[model samples]
Target chain A: MLGDALSLSLGYNATLVTLGATLLGAAAGMAGTFLYLRKNALISDAISHATLPGLGIAFLIAVAFGWDGRQLAILLGGSALSAALGLYFVNWLTRETRLTQDTAIGCILSVSFAFGVVLFTIIQVLPAGRKAGLESFLLGSTAGMLYSDALLILVLSIITALVLVVFLRPIKLVTFDASYSETLGISVRRVDFIILTLTLAVTVLGMKIVGLILIVALLIIPAVSARFWSEKTDIILITSTAFGALSGYIGSAISAVSAGLPTGPIIVLCAFGFFLISFLFAPKRGVLAVALKHYQFQKTVHLTQGLLSLALRQSIYEPKTRRLLQRFGYIRADGVVTEVGKSLAAKTLLNEKRWSYWQETLRESDQFDGQVVFSLMDIETKLTQDQILLIDQGLAARKGKKL
Target chain B: MMSGIALVSDKGVLLNAAADDRNAPFTIRGLTVSYGQVPAVYSIDFTAPAGSLIGILGPNGAGKSTLLKAAMGIVPVVSGQVSFFGKPLKEARYQVAYVPQRASVDWDFPATVYDVVLMGLYPILGLLRRVSKADKAKVAESLAKVGMQDFADRQIGQLSGGQQQRVFLARALTQRADVFLLDEPFSGVDAATETAIISVLKILQLEGKTVIAVHHDLSTVSTYFDHLFLLNRKAVAYGSVTKVFTKDNLVTAYGGKLGAAQLDAIGL
Candidate 1:
C-alpha cells in the first residue's frame, strides 16, 4: 500500500491520482468549513443536487457532437454550470420570492438531482452509448486516469483552495458573525460572496472525485471532526486539511480494491467514520466523555450529601460516626476521608454510611426512578438515618421553598 | 459604551476622561443606507476633529449602528462617502477601528480572547500573516488595557457577557487606530468593565484620536458625550449635547404621531 501510494504520488498515475484527490479534498474541506459555519450545510446539499441538470445538459451537448461527456470540460462544465445556476436560483428564490433559504435549497436540490439522473439515463440510451464513459463520471474511478482530466481538476482545485487560504481570516470572521466583521471595517457582504463563490468553485472542482452525492459530507465531516481536537481557527484548518488528505487517499485505495464501487461515496463514508470516532471518543467533546464526567460529578455530590445528612440526623453523630459517612465515600486517612476509593465503594455496602450512599445513588439513577425525578424516586427507595435527611433536603430544594 | 464614545461636556465634566489623547480620525459624510427598499439611514453626515469624542444617539432602530457601518464601508450606501484623515476607507483602513455591539454576535465562537484581539491586526497583517513579536506585544497591551491580560489565551465563549465585551474592547485597542467606532460598548457590562473601557476610550480621545459611538442609554448621554448626533432615520441634530439634545429636538426625533389616531400608525 505504501509503495503503491509513493509510486502513485511521484509517478504519473499515482501523482495524478494523489494530486487530484488531495486538491479536491482541500477544496471540499475549505468550502465545507464555511458552509458548516454559516448554517448553510444544506446549501451545499442543494448545490450538489442542482448540478445534475448541468451534467445532463453537458452530456446532451456532448452527444450532439459525438463526444464523451466525461471529458473534464463537459463533466465539470456541466456540474459547475448547473451548480452556479442552482446558486443563482437559490439567491433568487430567497431574494425575489417569499421562500426561506432552506426551502429554496430543497426545491432546487431535488429538482436538479432528478434532472441529473434523467440526463445520465439519456446518455446511456444512445445507440453507441455503451462506451460513453459514464461509469468513471458517475463513480469516480481515480485509478483509470487520462492525464489531462486529472490535471484540470488539480489546477481548478488549487486556485480555489489558495483563495480560501488567503482570505481565511475575513471569511472565518464573516461566517462567525457578519455584523461584527462589518463594523470592524471588513466587508461582510464581500466575505459572504467570496465564501459562496468559493463553495460553488470548490464543489464544481470536487465533483470529479468527491462526486455530487457525497461531496458535502467529505467537505463537512473532516472539519466537524477536527473541531473537537482544536479550538483555534489555524489549528482547526490544519487539522481539517490533514484529515481531508487521509480520507481522500483511503477512499481512493478502497475503490481500487472494490470493483464498480463509487469512489466519492466511499471517501465520504471514510470521513464520516472519522467523525463518528471523534464524536463518541474525543476527550473534549465526545459523548462518552460527557456521560462519564456527569457520572463522576454525581458520585461526588452523593457522597457529600450523605455525610452532611448523617451529621444532621444526630445533634452530632459521634466524631467516629460522623467520620463514618466520609469513610463510605473515601478511606478515613488522617481523620478525613481521602479522595480515593469512592467509585468502588459506591458499588458496595460496607457500613450504614456506605449503604446510605448506595441507596441514594440507586434512587437518583434511572434504575430506581423508571424515569421519574430523583426527589420523587427517593420516596420509593429505603435508606439509613443519614440518607433520609439528605433526600429530604434535596427534595426541599427542588420544591424551591427551601429549608 | 461601544457606540457611546467618551468626551467632555460643555461644563467641562470630562466624560470617559482616561483617553490617550485626541489625534487623527476619520470623517463620515453624506452616508445613506437602506435594507432592501426600507430606509434605515439617509443623508447622514458628520465629522470629528482628530481628537474629539462623539456619541451617536438615537432611540431603537434609529440607524445609529447603520451610520457606523457605513463609515466602515461595511454597509452598502445608496450614496455617500467616508474619509479617514482625508483618505478613503480602503486606503486608510488600518488607521481606523470598530467595536461592534456585544449582543450583535454569538460569543460562543470557537476562539480564544487572544485570537479575538489579534484580528484587529488582520488588515496590516493580511491573511496568512504570522503574529510577530510586535503583534504579540500589541495584543498583550490591548488585553492589559482592558484588564484582561491574564485571560488572553482563554476561550472567548467561556467568558461572561461583560468579559466578552472587554475582550472585544481589547480587540479594538489592538488596532491602535486614530479613530474608533464602537456600537453599544457598555451594554451588559458590569460597572468595573464599563469604567475600564471608558478609561481606554478616554486615553484614546486625549491622545487626539477621535471616537464615534452609537449609544442607546440616555442617562449616560450627557456624561460621556462631547459631540452628539441625535438621529431618527435622518440627522435630527448634530453638535454639542446642549445645542442638540433638548426636549424639542428629542420630541422631533421620536415624539412624532403622538395623537391618539397617529398612535395607531406607530403600532402604539
Candidate 2:
C-alpha cells in the first residue's frame, strides 16, 4: 500500500495522513491511560456514544452553512457538548445515586446514542434532496478527511498531550490513591475535571477517522495492552503511545486499501492484537506466562513431595528398595515406566524439582539442610502434616511460635 | 531510646509522655475540611511540638483521616488557618511529607518502588529542575532506611501490602520534610512493617521532625504517641497522651455518648 501510494505521487499526503493518524492515536493512548487507571474505561465509551447527536446537529449546521464553510468548528462544538453531557451524567449517576460506574456508563451510552439516531432520522425524514453526509459521522469515514482535518487533530492532540504531561505527577499520585491525594493537598475535583476535559477534546478530534461509536476503542485498547507490557508509569505511557500509533497506522492503511472493512473494528482489532500478544508473552504478568510459571511451580512441588515421601521410607531401602516401592504404584510391567515415573527421574531430577514443592513448607518451618529443628508440635501445637509444611515454609503459622 | 524495641502497632507504645519537643512544629485554628455539601471534617484545633510522635485516633467515621488531610492542605479547609513553622502550608510545601492510606491508591499502577519514592521530591523538583543524582540518592537512602533497598526496582503492584506501605514511607522520607502526616499508615500492617516505619520515623524525630498520624484501633493510642488528637466532627481533645488520652478522653474521642459509635477495642 505504501508502495502504491508512493507510485501514484500521493505519497506525501498518504504519509502525512498516517502521521496525523499516529498523532491522534498517541493522544488517545495518553488520555486512555488515566481512564484505565481511574477505573473509568467505560467513560470514554459512553462519551463516544453520546457524541452521535452532536454529529447530526453539526451536519445540520454544516449543510445550512455549506460543506466548505465551518464544518470542523461545528463538529467539534457539537461533539464537545455531547461529551460534556455524557460526563455530567456519568458523574451524576455514579455519585448522586448508588448505581455502579459500569451501569451508569452503559445507560448513558445507549440512551444518548439512541437520541443521536433519532435526531439523524428526524432530519432526513423526507429525504430532503441532500445527501446524508451527517449520518456518515455516526460510524466515521476517512473519505472526507483532508489536510485541514489532519492539522486540527494535530493541534488538539498536542494540547491534550501537554495537559497529560503538566499534571503527570498529580495524576500519578491520584490514580494510585485519590483519598490520599486529597489528603496531600491535591484537589480531586480539579484532577477529575482535567481528565474528563482531555477525554472530551481527544474524542472530538478523533471523531473524524474512527467516528463517535468506535473512537473509544482507539482510546482504551492501547492502555489495556500497556498494562501487560510495563509496570512503571513512564514506560506504560510511552508504550501505550507507541502501540497506539502502530494500531492507528495499521488500521488506516487497512481501511484505505482493503476492499471492505470497517475502520473502527480494524483499529480496535489491531489494538486487541497488541493486547493479546502482551497478555500471552509478557514476561511475568502475561496470562500464559503466569500459567506456565504456576505449572512449573506445581510440577517441582510434586517432585519434591515424592522425594520427601521416598525419604520417609527406611534408609535400609537405599536405592533399589525405593525403586521397588515406586514400582508398586507407578511402574509398568511392559518395561516402559509411566510418564509420571519418567518425570520423577533419578534422585538428581527429583532433588531438582523438590524445592518447588518443599520451599513453601520448609520456608514456613524455617528449616534448612532438610533438617527441621522445630517439630510441628513445637511450632504450632498440632502435628498435622499441613501445619508442619506451613511451619517449614516460614509462614505466620510457625514464624514467631516456639517449637 | 530503648534497645531492640518492638514497633508499636498504634500511636500508643511509640509515643512517650516525655517525647514532646519544646518547639512545636505546627498550629491549627478552626481548621475544617468539607467534601462538596458533606463535611468530612468540621472544625479541628491542635498543635504539635517538634520531635514528637502524635496519634490522631477515632472510630471509623470519626474524621481522623480528614483532620490530618486538612492540616496537610490536601483536603480543602472550608474555613480555617494552618501554620507550619508559623507560615501557611503553601509557603512550607516542601517541609511537609504526606504518606497516604495504604488502600487509597491503585497498587497495580505501573511504577517501580524507586520511581514512586522519587515522587516525594516533586515539591522540591517542581517545574523544570530535572531530578538530579542527589534526588536519586535520597530515594535510595529512603528505600534503604525502610529495608526495601533490595526491592527498589520492583513494580509497586507486585509487592505485598506491608512492602507497599514501606515504599510510601520511603517516598515520604525523600521529601526531607520537617513534618509528616500519615493517613492510616499502620492499618493492615505486619509487625515488621510497623517496626520498619517506626524506625524511619525515629530517624526523622531524632532530626527534630513532627510526625502526625491518623490512626484507628484505639488500644495502642496511649503507648504509641507522645500527643493525641481525638476528633469526631470537632476537636475533642489535643494535648499530651497523659493529659488528653485519659479514659475519659477516650470516651470523648470515641464519641463517648456524642455519636452512636461506641469505643470498640482493637488491639493496638
Candidate 3:
C-alpha cells in the first residue's frame, strides 16, 4: 500500500496537477476569508459564473486570429475581464438602482451564466469551434492539463498569496469593520476594491481546477470550516488556507486514481467533507460540543430546581436531592449547599417565577399559550403537569389571589 | 513640545493654525450631513475645548450618530469641514480615535479581546508592518486600565453587553489618541460598567484628552460632561453644562414637549 501511494504521488503529470490544484486552493481560501467575513461569500459564485462568457469570447477572438484559442494566458485574461465587469455591474445595481445586494448578485450570476451558455452553443457550430476543447472547463478535466497550464496556475497563486501577506493588516481591519477602519485613516473604498480584485483574480485562475460552477465551494467551505477551529483572524486565515490545500491535494489525487471521474466535482466533494467534519467535531463551536454544553446546562437547571423545591418544603434538601446535587457539584461532601449551588438555585427560581408571572398576566389578558412558554424556554425536558399547576398557583397568589 | 499637539488660544478663540500656532483641539464649521438628499445634521458649528468631557444630547433621530460619523468621515458630508488639532482628519488621524456604537460590529466575528485591541496599533504601525512586542505590551496595559486584563484571550462574542463595551473602551485607550469621539458608549451598559467607563473618561480628561460622546441618559449628563451640545438636526445649544443644560434647551431639542420639572427631576 505504501509503494502504491508513493508511485502514484511520484507520477510526473500527477505531481504537477496536484501541485497546481493545491496552490489554487490555498490562494482562493486566503481571499475567501475576507469575502466570508464581509458577508459577501456569494460574490465569488457570481464572479466565477460570470467568467464563463469571458472564456467563450476569448476563444472566439483567438480563433479569429487563426491562433490556438486555448492559450492559458489569453483565456484567463478574458475570464478576469468578464469577472471584473460582473463585479462592477453588481456594485452599480446595488448602489444606483436600489436593488439589494443579494438581488444584484443573483441577477448578474444568472444572466452572465445564461449568456455564457448561449455563447457556448454558438461556438459549437462555428467552423473551428468544435476543436476548441473549451468544454473541459465546465467540469475540470485535470488529465488535460499541460505543464504550462499548471505553471500558469502556480504563478498566479504565488502572486495572490504574496499580495495577501503584504496587505494583511489593512485587510483584517476592513473585514472586521469598514466604517471603523476609515476613522483610522484607511480608505475603505480602496481597500474594498483591492480585496474584490484579488478575489476576481483567484476566481479566474481557479476556474480550470475546480470549474466555475464549483469554485465557490473551494472559497467558502475552507473559510467557514476554519471558523470552527479558531477565534483569531490570523489563525483562521492560516487554518483555512491549510484546509484548502489539503482538499485540493487529496481531491486531485483521488480523481487521478479513478478514471472517468472529473476533478472539479471530486475537489468540491472533498471540501464538503472537511466542512462536515468541522461542523460535527470541532471543539467549542461544533454541533456535538454545543449539544454537550447545552445538555449539561439543562441538567444543572433541573438539579437547581429540585434543590430549591426541597429547601422550600423542609428547610433542607431531601436526601435523594442532596445526593444528586452533590454529584453535580452543587453541594459539598459535608451535605451543605455550596455557594455556587445556592446562587444557581436562587437564580433559577427567580427566572421561573418571573416567567410564570408574565404567563399569568398574559393569560388574564387572553393572550397566553403554554406551548409558547415551553418553546421559548427551549429545554429538552417536558414540564410535568404538577409543576405547571404549581407555577400557576404561585403566580396567582403573588397577584393577591389564589388559583 | 509635541510637534502635532494643538494648543488652545488664551482668548477662548478658534485660530486658523496656519496663521497662528495655537489650534483648537476640535472644531466643525458649517458641517451639514445628509442621507441621499434628506438632511441629518444641518449647518452645525462648534469649537470644543481641550481636556474637557462633552456630551452630545439629543432626541432619537436627531442625527447625533450622523454627526459623529460625519466627523470621522465615515459618512459623506453635504458640505462641511471637520478639523482635529487644527489639521484635516487624515493628517491628524493618529492623534484622534473614534469608538463606534457597540451594535455596529458583529460580535460573533472570529476574534479575541486581545486581537481586537491589537487593531489599535495598526494605524501607528502603518501598512505591511507586523505588530511588535511593545505593541502587545501596550494592549495588555490598556486592558488592565479597563479592568479586563483577565479576559484578554476570551472570544468577544462570549462577553456580556457591558463587558463588550469595556473591551471596546480598552481598544480605544490602546490607540492612545488625544481626542476621542464615542457613540452611545453607555446605552446598554450596566451601572457598574458605566461607572467604570466614566472613571476612565475622567482620567483621560485629566490627562488632557478631548472626549465627546453621544449620550442618551439626561440624568447623568451633568455628572458626565463639563460641556454639552444639545442637538436636533441643528445645534440648539452649545456651551458649558451649567449654562446650556437648561429647561428651554431641553424643550427646543425635544420639540418643546419637555417640562422644567422633568429637567429638574433628572438633575439637570
Candidate 4:
C-alpha cells in the first residue's frame, strides 16, 4: 500500500498537479495569516464566491466573441475582475454605510453567488449547451488541469509568496494594528489594497484546484492549525506553509488513488485532519493537553479531599502517599494536624452531613428507623488501633441512641 | 524649561516654548472630529512645544483619546489640521510616533515583543527596504529602555498588562522620533509600570522629544505631566498643569460628577 501510494504520489500524471496545488496551498496559508489576524476570513469566501459570476460573464463574452468559452486566461481574467468588483463593493458598503465588514461580505457573497447561479443556468440553455464542463469550477474538477494551468498556479503562488515576504514588515504592522500603522505613516488603505489584491489573485488561481467554495478552507485551516503549534508570527507562517503543502500533496495523492473522491473535498478533508490533530494533540494549546492538565488538577483535589477526610477519621497515612500529601502541605510527617487542618477536616465532615435529615442520626422511635446507615468498613482498614476504637465507640453511641 | 522661550497661553502660564518656536512638535488648529452624527472632539486648538510632557485628560466620554488619535490622523478630523515640527503630518512623518490604547489592539496577534518593536523601523525602512544592523540595535535599545530586553522573544499576549504597555512604549521608542503620542499608557498597569512609563516620558522630554499622552487617572495628572489639556467634546483648558488643572475646569470636563474637594484632593 505504501509503495502504491508512493508510486501514485510520484506519477507523471499527478506530479504537476500536486506541485501546483501544494504551492497554491502554501501561498493561501501565507496570505491567510494576515487575513486571519485582521479577522476577515469571510472576505476570502466572499471574493471566491464573487469570482463565479465573473467566470459566467467571461464565458458568455468568449462565446459572443466566437472564441472558446473554456479558455483559461479569459475565464480567470473575468474571475479576477468580478472578484475585485465584489471586494470594492464590500469596502464601499462598509465605508459609506453603517454595515460592518461582516454584513458587507455576506451581502456580496450571497448576491454574487446567486448571480453566478443564474448565469450558469442561463448559459446551460444557450446554444453552447452546458458550457463544456464549466460547472466544474463550482466544486473544482482537477482531472482536466492542463500543464499550462498547473504552471500558471505555480508561478502565481510563487509571486504571491515573494511579494508577501517583500512587504512582510509593513503588512504585519498594518494587519496587527491598521490605525497605529497609519499613525506611523504607513498608508493603511494601500497596504490593505495590496493584501486584498493578492488574496484575489491567489483565490482566483486556486479555484482550478480547490474550487471557490473550499479554497478558503485551505487558506484558513492551515494557518489556524499552525496557530495551535506556535505563537511567533514567523514560526506560524512557516508551519502554516508546511501544513498547506502537506495537505495539498497528501490530499491530491489520496484523491488520485480513490478515483471517485473530488480533489477539492479531499484537500479540505486533509487540512481538516491536520486541524483535528492539532486541536486534540498539540502541546500546551490542544484540547487533549488542556484536558489532561485539568484532569490531573481535579485528581489532585479529589485525593486531597479524600486524604483530609481520612486524616480526620484518624487513619495513618501510607508513607508513599503521605509524602505526596505532605508535599501539598495537607498533613505533617508526624501525623498530627494543627487548628487550620482541624477546621478544614471539620468542614469536610460537615459537608457530608444531610441537613434535611439531622434528626434521623439522633434517637429513632423504632429499631428499624428506615434511616440508612453508612458502612465504615473502608475507613476501618486504614485506621490504627486507637482510631478504630474511637470509631467503634462513635458507631455504638449512634446505634444505642435508637429507641 | 528652555533652550529658548516663545510663549502663548490663554491661561497666562508658560507651559513650554510657543508656536513661534517653529519646531513645535505638534500643532492642532481648530480640529474637530465626529463619529457619524455625534461629535467626539470639537474645535480643539493647541501647540505643544518640543520637550514637553503633555497630558490629554477628560472623563470617559470627553474625547481625550479622540484628540490624540485625530492629531495622529488615526481618526478622521471633521475640520482643521495637525502639523509636526512646523510641517504637515505627512511631510514630517518620520518624527512622529503614536502608541495606541492598549485595549485597541488584539493581544493574541502572532507577534513577539521583538517583532512588534521592529515594526517601528518600517516607516524609515520604507516598503522595500530591509532592517539594518543599526535598526536592530535601535530595537534592542528601545526594549532595554522599557526594561523589556529580556522578554524580546516572548509572545506579546503572554505579557501582563503593564508589560504589554511597556512593549508598546518600546515600539514607540524604536521610532526615535521627535514626538510621541501615547494613548492611556498607564491604564490597567501597575503603579511601578506607571512610574517606569512616566520616567521614560521624562527622559524623552529631556532629550527634546515631545510626549503627549492620554491620561485617565486624574490623581496622577499633576505628577506625570507638566502641561495639560482638559477636554469635554471641546477644549476646556490647555496650559501648565498648575494653571489648567483647576476645580472649575474639572467640573466642566467631568460634568459636575467630581466634587470640588475631590478635585482639590487630586491636587487640582
Candidate 5:
C-alpha cells in the first residue's frame, strides 16, 4: 500500500494532494530562508496562528450566504486577510510601543487565536457546522480534498516561487544589511513587506496541508537544517527548498497509505527527520563532523605528548597513548622505543626547544613574522625553511652558552 | 565653564557659499535628530570641502555617529538639510558611499567576503541585471586594495575583527563614490588595519574625494584629519585640526571628562 502511494498509483485525488503538498513545502522552504536570515522566524508563528480567526469568520459568512463554507478559495482568502492584519499588528506594536518584536508577536498570536477558538466553539454547537470537518484544518486532513483545492495550492506555490526568484537578490541584500541596502537605493521597507507577504502566502497555503499549528515548522526547520550544509546564501536556499519538498512529498505519501493518519503531523515529522540528519551528519558544522575534528586534535596532542615522553625517557602511563604508539610501531609492549620512535622523538623535542627559544628570546624583537601561530599545527607548515634554520641556530647558540 | 575664545559662527558665511560652490562635498544646515523625546544631535551646521579628510570627534553619547547617520538619511531628522556636491542627498546618492559600523550587522550571516563586496554594485546594476565580468574584476580590485584578495571565498564570520573591518573598507572602495562617510572605521581594528585604512583615506583625499569619518582616538586626530568638527550634541568647533582641536574644545566636548595630563599627552 505504501509503495503504491509512493509511486503515485493511489488514484487521481491522492496524486493531486501529494503534488500540491510538495509544491507548498518547496515554497515555504524558499520563502522561509529570507525570514530565517532576517532573524524573524517566530513571526511566521504569529501570522499562522492569527489566520484561525479569519478562517472562522469566513466560514460563518459563507454559511450565512448559503454557500459551501469550506470553499478552499474563500477560506484561504479570509485567512490571508487575517494573517496580513496579524502581521501588521505585530509590526505596529513593535514600532509604536515599548514592546519588543517577540513580545508583540506573542500578544497578537494569543489574542487572535483565542478569539478564533471562541468562534470555533460557537460554530461547533450549530447544526450545519456539525459536519463541517473544520477540525481537519488543525492537524490537516487531505482525505476529502477537492480538485480545485489542490489546483489552488499548486498555483499559489508556483507564484510564490517565481516571486522569490525575481526578488532573491534584493531580499538577500536587505536581510544581510538593511542600512546598506537603503544606501544603495533599495527600499528596505518594501523588501521587508515583500518578505512578510511571501511568508503570509506560505502560511495560508500550508493550512490545508500542514495546518496552522505546524506550518511554522515547515517554514523554519528546513531553513535551519540547510544552514548546517553550506555557507553560501544561494546554496543554502536551494538546499532548504529541496529538503522541504522532499519532506512534503514523502510525508503525504505515507499519510495516504494509512487509514487514520493526518498529513500535517507526518509532514512535520519528515521535516524534523531531515533536521536531525543534517544536525548529526552534515559536514563542517554538523555534530558528527565537529566531534570527529575534536577527536583528531586529541589524537595529535596525545601522540605529540607521547613522543615528548619518549624523548625525555619518561614512562608512558596512558594506556591509549601506549596502544597508539604500539600500533604505529613506535614502541614495543616491553616499553622499548624503536629507531623510528627515536628519530620522531628527537625531532619533536628539537621543535619544542626551538619554539620556546623563539618565544623567550626572538619574540619581542619583531624579526619573525607575527602571523605564524607556533602551537597546535606543525611549525614547519607556518615558517619558511630559512626561518626555521635561523631559529635552530639560535637554539643551538643558547644551549652552547648554557653549557 | 566653556573657556574657548568666542569665534564667529561658521554657519551663515558658508551657507550661501555652500549653495553656490557646487564643489563642496557635503553641506549640512540645522541638522537635528532625536530618539524618542531625547535629542541625539541638536541643530548643527557644517560643510566639508573637496579633497579633504575630515573627522567628527566627540565623547561617548555625544552624537558623533548620529550626525553621520542623519546625514545619510538612515535616521529621521527632526529638521535638517543635507546635500552632496551642492545637491540633496537623494539626487546625489550614487555619488556618495556610506560604511556603517561593523558591529551594526550580524557577522554570522551566510555570505562570503566576495559576496559582501559585490553588493557595492547593487545600485548600479539595479534589479534584474546580471553581474558582468568587469563587475567581478572590480570586486577583485577592491578586495586587493584592502589586502583581502586571498580571503574572497572565506565565510565572513570566519575572519578576525580587523579583517572584518578591512572587508567593509573594501566594500566601500568598490562603490567608487565621490564622497565617503565612515562610522568609527578604526574602532576595534588592529594597528595594521588602522594604518591601512588611514592610508586608503589619504589616497582617496589625494584623488580629490571627500572623506568624513567618525573618529574616537584623539592622539591620531592631528595626523589623520586635515579638518576636524568637534561636536557634543552640537558643533563645538569646525575648522583645520590645528585650530579646532584646542584645550577649550576638548573640555567642552567632553565636559571635563579629559584629565589635564591626558589632554597634555595628545598635545591639546
Candidate 6:
C-alpha cells in the first residue's frame, strides 16, 4: 500500500497533493538556505505564525461575498499579506527601538498568533465557518485538497525556487559580508528584501501542506542538516533541497496510506530524521566522525607513549596503553617489550628530540611555527634527509662534548 | 630644532597646497560621524597627496576606525563631504578599495579563499555575467601577490588569523583601485604576515596608488607611513611622521593615555 502511494498510484487527489507538497518542500529548503546563512531563522517563525490572522480574515471575506471561503488562492494571498506585515513590524521594532531582532520576532510571533487564535475561535462560532476546514491550516490536511489548490501550490513553489536560484549569488554575498557587499555596489537592503520575499513566499505556500507552526521546521531543519554534510554553499543548498523534497514526498505518501496521520507533523518528523542522521554520521563535522577522530588520536598518543616507555626500559602502568601496545605487537602479553617495540620506541624518541632541537634552532624564526609540534608523524616527512643528518650530527657532537 | 621647525613649515605649505589640489587621492572636509547621539568623529578635515602611504593613528575609542568607515561611506557621516580623486565617493567608488577589520566578518562562512577573493570582481560582473578567463586570472594574480596561492581551495575558516587577513588583502588587491583604505590591517597578525602586508602596500605605493591604513603600533609609524593623520574624535595633528609624531601630539591625541615614559619608549 505504501509503495503504491509513493509511486503515485494512490489516485488523482493524493498524487497532486504529494507532488505539491514535494515542490513546496524544495522551495522552502532553497529559500531557507539564505535565511539560515543570515542567522535569521527565527524570523520565519514569526512570519508563518502571523499568517493565521490573514487566513481567518480571508475566510471571512470569502464567506461575506457568499463565495466558497476555503479558496486556496484567496487564503494564500491573505496569509502572504499578513506575513509581510509581520516581517515589516519586526524590522521596524528592531530598527526604531532598542529591541533586538529575536525580541522583535518573539513579540510579533506571540501577539499575531494570539490574534489569529482569537479569529479562529470567532470563525468557528459562525454558521458559515462550521465546515470551513480552517483547522487544516494549523497542522495541514491534504485529504480533501482540490486539484486546482494543489496545482497552484506546485506552480508557486516552482517560481519561488527559480527566483532563489537566480538571486543566490548576490544574496550569498550580502549575507556573508554586508559591508563588503556595500563597497561592491550590491545594495544590502535590496538583497535582504529579496530574501524576505522568498521566505514569505515559501511560508505562505507551505502553510497548506506543512501548516503555519511546522513550516519553520521545513525552512530551518533541512538547511541545518545540510550544513553537517559539506563546507560548500552550493553543495549545502542542493543537499538541503533534496532533503526537503524527500521528506515531503515520503511524509505525504505515508499520510495518503494512513488515514489518521497529519501531513505536516509527519513531514517535520521526516526532516528531523535527516537531521539526526546527519548529526551522528556525516563525515568531517558529524558527531560520530569527531568521536572517531578523537579515539584515533587518543590511541596514537597511548601507543606512542607506550613505545617511548619501552625505549626507556620503563614499565607500562596504564592498562589501555599496555593493551594498545600488545595489539600493535609492540609489547608481549607479559608486559615485556618486543624487538619491534624497541626500534619503534627509539624512532619515536628520536623524532621527539629532533622536533625539540628544530624548535630551539628556529625560535627566532616563525617559518615553521604551527607545524613543528611533536606528533606521531615521521620526522623524515617534515624535513629533508640533509637536515635530519645535520641534526643527528649536532646531537652526536653534543654527546661528545658531554663525554 | 631648527631643522625640525623647517620641516614643519615645509609640511604646512604642502598641506595647504594639497587642500586645493583638486586631484588629491582623497579629501575629507568637515567630516563628523555619530553613533546615535554620541559623536565618534567630529569635524575632521584632511587631504591625502597622490602616491603616498598615510596612517590614521589614535588610541582606543579615538575614532581612527570610525574615520575610515565614514570616509569609505560604509558608515553614515553626520555632516561631511568625502571626495575621491576630486569626485564624490559614489561617482568614484570603483577607484577606491576598502579592507575592513578581519573581526568584522564571520570567517566561518562557507567559501574558499579563491571564492572570497573572486568577490572582488562582483561589481563589474553584475547580474547575468559569467566570470571570464581574465577575471579568474586577476583573482589568481591577487592571490599570488599575497603568497596565498597554495590556500586557494582551502575553506576560509581553516586558515590562521594572519592568513585570513592576507586573503582579505588579496580581495582588495583584486579591485586594482587607485586608493586603498585598510582598518587595523596589522593587528593580531604574525610578524611574517605583517612583513607580507607591508611589502604589498609598498608595492602599491610604488605603483602610484594611495594606501591609507588605520595603524596602532606607534613604533612602526615612521617606518611604515610617509604621512600620518593623528585623530582623537577630531584632527589632532596631520603631516609627515617626523613633523607630527611628537610628544605633545601623542599626548593630545591619546589624552593622558600616553604617559611620559610610554612616549619616551616610542621615541616621541
Question: After best superposition, candidate 5 residue A344: deviation in angstroms?
Answer: 2.8
Per-chain TM-score, chain A, candidate 4: 0.75
RMSD of each: 10.9, 8.3, 9.3, 12.5, 4.9, 3.9
How high is each candidate's interface RMSD, in Å?
A: 9.5, 6.1, 8.4, 16.4, 3.7, 2.2
Which pairs clash in model 5? Answer: none
Q: Which ranking of candidates, highest TM-score first?
A: 6, 5, 3, 4, 2, 1
- In candidate 2, how many Å is residue B104 off? 1.0
DockQ of 3: 0.34
Every model's TM-score: 0.75, 0.78, 0.84, 0.83, 0.91, 0.93
Which has the better TM-score: candidate 4, or candidate 6? 6
Q: Judged by lDDT against the true structure, how good is candidate 5?
A: 0.86
DockQ for every model comes to: 0.23, 0.29, 0.34, 0.30, 0.45, 0.47
Writing each residue's lDDT as its tens digit, candidate 4 over A1-403 gives 4345445555666776777778888888888877787788889999999999999999999999999999889999999999999999999999999999999999999999999999999999988947467788877888867889888988887888888888888888888988889987778899888888888988999888889899889889998999899887778888888888888878887777777889889888999999999999999889999999888765555544555556467665456555555666666767666555666556545333322123344322221122233221133333356654555565557668993
Q: Which scores better on TM-score, 3 or 6?
A: 6
* lDDT string, candidate 5, A1-403, tens digits: 8888888899998998899889889999998888999999999999999999999999999999999997888888899999999999999999889999999999999999999899899999988788887777777778777788778878877888888888878998999989888887788889999998989998988899889999999999999999999999999999999999999999999999887788999999999999999999999999999999989888888888899899999998999999888888899878799999999989888778878776786553322323434544577876679878989898778789999
| lDDT of residue B12 for candidate 4 | 46
lDDT of 1 at A259: 60
What TM-score does structure 1 among the candidates reach?
A: 0.75
Evaluate fnat for each of the predicted models and list the values in order.
0.53, 0.51, 0.80, 0.75, 0.65, 0.41
Residue B254 of candidate 5: its Cα lDDT? 91
Error of 2 at B255 (Å): 7.3
Window of ten residues with lowest summed lDDT in model 1 chain A: A365-374
The Cα local distance difference test for each model comes to: 0.70, 0.71, 0.81, 0.80, 0.86, 0.86
Instruction: Give the runs in model 5 whose Cα sits over 4 Å from its true position.
Output: A301-342, A349-372, A382-403, B1-23
lDDT of 5 at A229: 98
Tens-digit per-residue lDDT, A218-281, candidate 6: 9999999999998889999999999999999999999889988999999999999999999999
B62-177 in candidate 3: lDDT tens per residue? Answer: 99999999999999899988988778898888888888899898999988899888888888888777678999999999998888888888888888788788888898898999
The clash count for each model shown is: 32, 40, 0, 1, 0, 0
